[model samples]
Target: MAVAPQVLPHTAISTWSGFVYQGKLALYHCLKLMSSDYAANRDLKLQLESQDDFAIFRRQQCLSMHQVKAYKDPRFSAYSDGISTQRDNARQRGVALAYFHVAREVTNVPATFVADYGPVRFYTYPIPPDAAGNVIQSFCPLNQVDMFIRDELSSLLVNAAMQPAWKNYIVANIQNTLEAIVNLKVIMTHSKIHESTRHQTVIAASEFIEFSELYDVIEANDYAPFENEAFFLSRLQIDIGTYYQEFCERQDSLSQAACQKLDDYLAAITSLNVEGMKAFLRATMPHKKGRFKTLSEFKDQSLDRDAMRLGMFTIFWKLVQTARNDGSDVAFSWLNDGLFYYPTGIHHAAEHQESICHDIMQQAISEDVECLFECGALITSAIDRPSISDVIIGIDATEGVDTAEHELLRENRIGNYKKVAMISLNNVPESLKDAEPD
Candidate 1:
């Protein structure tokens, strides 16, 4: 865990920076173990040095720290797309030896220690071994590794920054380490979820947390995270899906509606062409073609947008049908992602929002539909009452029009009234409000 400032010179720093930023040097390079004596100090040292034996893989322009002339590979690099581990090389033993505790804890991490690395706060919890195996011979690799990583990060902080906070102790580069651990996870989880899935780290979640925390710290002054909803939403949705899946699995029946949907979905799975089936599916669920802003539009311009949503929904519904027809598993997979699933990725669930929309519309009807209707009638009444329809006559000014920017009110030149307000076309039948006269 001993880490001292490597004393990277200014020129070396600039060169390394350019190499990393330009994608020359990947975050990690695989190293091999030296001799059979994994415990021997000299063996471990030689193994770590062996990492330099292989020419680093990259395009020719990427070579900056090269000590030798460019040499072509006798046999191409073993890994193509990022491989977790290269054939155990002697050169990597130094890292292994230095990070041996990291290796130990990988096998012996404790449950409480893992929880301490709260996914929410993302502050890593490290557990280092003070004394070796107890007299009882009980060992927790997870605890050992966490402690090692935590301690190592603490030491690195002394050199990395002038004043490193507790936050810096949780390293972001641990994804590679984690991925390797998950793949090499001989360690088991009691949770019903697949060990692979339960532990699989999404890089984006880290980015989101880092960006969010960065925003919180620096937001008061000048720092603004350029990343938008898309960056956050994709990862958030994955988390949501994972959580929902867990909830569903934990309970015998997660939701009656979900169960019914699955049942209907299953029943319809066989008879793909039935309109009765499709109709039932349409009634019970949301589809891609039905994407919408809101069911209750208070503006005229919203109709086109809603129409576009409806069109997307139609495409989504059929797309869902097609995916279902092709394979239910595929349909579920796509639904989980909110994508069209096969090709289009048109966000089809928006199309069938009515399933949720029905609840909203019903609440409006049940609460105060009559009072709403009556109040609206008074303002639009052609006969009795103080109707503001003809009150504001001969008005030519557009001063107050800015408030109606969304087309909640339509401009109508009715005879003497140059521009009179009328309820927008897409709004409910409830906008006939009494207004001031000109």
Candidate 2:
């Protein structure tokens, strides 16, 4: 159902936090922040799910709001003590509603209840649930969530962007979150596919609506939240092509809607200028001085080996500066697409005809994507599968540029260096460079 105008409505808000949220929303007029700093503590989440911890969660939320209201108790309303007293009713109620994440988990708060009037108005109500199959714990208000997390997550991400000492921990958490969100989408897709196939086999047509209302508040972020790496999509995999041809017809019909959505999205993305669009084209690409001097210069370029290393830090900083000042988290999902679409982006020794992996590795290391270290006794490691990548980038070679790799190369590393992956060794040939150990 379309959300009523009251819950996160479109009017200009008046509360301080609401104003801040508005300010951030204005800043990122069209951006989404997929944080490199998002860390879902499963242990903590599970602990929050426990019946014992419900009170703590509620208390934290309620007290936090109470304190906030008191501090910013500007002359907004007359309800001196209640949540309605705030300048922005939706903003205050939002925080209060989230406390229901606790109430629904621990107490007898039903997920949805009928608020009956003479008209029997049925608003989407918050119901309580136990730790088992709990949805409330996972319910993050698309608008309210990062308002609390921005500062903490930004500090963490900026630090990690610099390749912090605890970068391994951060990378592991990020990967784990990615896996969880991806798996969640997969699970949702499978369930939808099963339901869809069954419905098609039995009935003529059926539609499955979802709690995608969350996708509504994510508008300021340009619905980019829906395109998130972890977005929940219901993929219907009917036997599209079959001897009976019934499934084929069904797929053909559905493809119309799907293709239209895809076209709209693609068109929106294409509106970016040449340089902005090229970042997504490849990871790293070299440019000649005068070839299409401005970003308007375009050429039909195929996939290249060093594509991942092609972009600069300033590009991401531009996006970040736009996002942070406006008010959105950096969407790190772009990294996933980069990895999948440009698998061979990492610099390879054979491709470039030189032992550049040492330089890349040095860069990844100083920036905190350090794969391994030959410590006193134990083999110290930072990231997962860098050992595998060491082989791909040819960084494991005992000979070739071992002792003299430039440390300056390390400082040049940019953006989530820990997640840096390697692809093919289609680089320079054997006579590319002397295997100098200087």
Candidate 1 lDDT over residue span 166-232, tens digit each = 4453343232232222211111111111122322222111111111222123112221232222222
Error of model 1, residue 136, in angstroms: 19
Q: So what's the TM-score on candidate 2?
A: 0.20
Candidate 2 regions exceeding 4 Å error are: 1-257, 283-298, 302-408, 411-418, 422-438
Q: Taking the tens digit of each residue's C-alpha lDDT, what string does model 2 give over 1-438?
A: 986673211211111112122222211211112222223211111111111111112211321111111122223232223322222332533433212111011222234422211111111212257668543342223234334334333344445334334434343333223323323332232233333423421221111111122112221223334333222111000000011112112232323333333222222222233333333222233111122222323232323212322222112211111111112111111222223111122332334422343454443332222122211010011111232223234343322334455443332332233344433322212222123211
Cα TM-score per model: 0.23, 0.20
Q: How many pairs collide in each candidate, listed in order?
A: 39, 31
